[model samples]
Target: MNALKGQTLEIVQEEFANKILQIQGVGGFILVRNNGQLLASKTDMTTDPQTLAAMMILSSQDCKTLQSTMGFSRYHYLMVTQEKIGKLY
Candidate 1:
């Protein structure tokens, strides 16, 4: 067996959060309280924590609802498809 070293899940998430959207293709909108309380956002070159946070709220709800319906034993964040996922340019 090989020994693994280095960052934890939190560390990885924080690192990604600290930087702008490093993923190749993704666009998002945050929906809070089942509505639009806040707007979370990220991009290749966008710096806005509040926006990203708002997205967290929306994502949370999506996960919760899915869990309730799907009866998931564990809960995690929700991640729908991003607009930039396709190549139609």
Candidate 2:
């Protein structure tokens, strides 16, 4: 299938983020490619979206590698929590 590009992709991204933001307690939304490119993000958080995307993508890869080495299946979700900060998913 042909992937969206240019203005078309931007519209879709905005629509998706708007829909998600409509849900209660939804503070942010971000979409990043496997290569660590920031496609779209709508966030009110202090952390930079680009930095967060890169870190999350890299950590996800590491987690997958660790899981495979342990002979485990893929995880449905990953969450990280810090007492001084907060939770990340």
Scored by TM-score, the top model is 2
lDDT of 2 by residue, 5-87 (tens): 65576677777779888999877777788899898888776788999899889888988998989988888877878675477
The number of the candidate with the highest lDDT is 2
Q: Give the local distance difference test score of model 1.
A: 0.48
What are the models' TM-scores?
A: 0.36, 0.79
Instruction: Give residue 12's error in model 1 in angstroms.
Output: 21
- For model 2, the superposed segments whose C-alpha errors exceed 4 Å read 1-7, 83-85
Q: Which parts of model 1 are misplaced by more than 4 Å? A: 1-45, 77-89
Clashes of 2: 0
- Per-candidate Cα lDDT values, in order, are 0.48, 0.80
Error of 2 at 38 (Å): 0.9
lDDT of 2 at 19: 88
lDDT of 1 by residue, 1-89 (tens): 12236766555544554453454544532223445443233334243545556566666677787889999866644444546543211
lDDT score of residue 42 within candidate 2: 85
RMSD of each: 9.6, 3.0
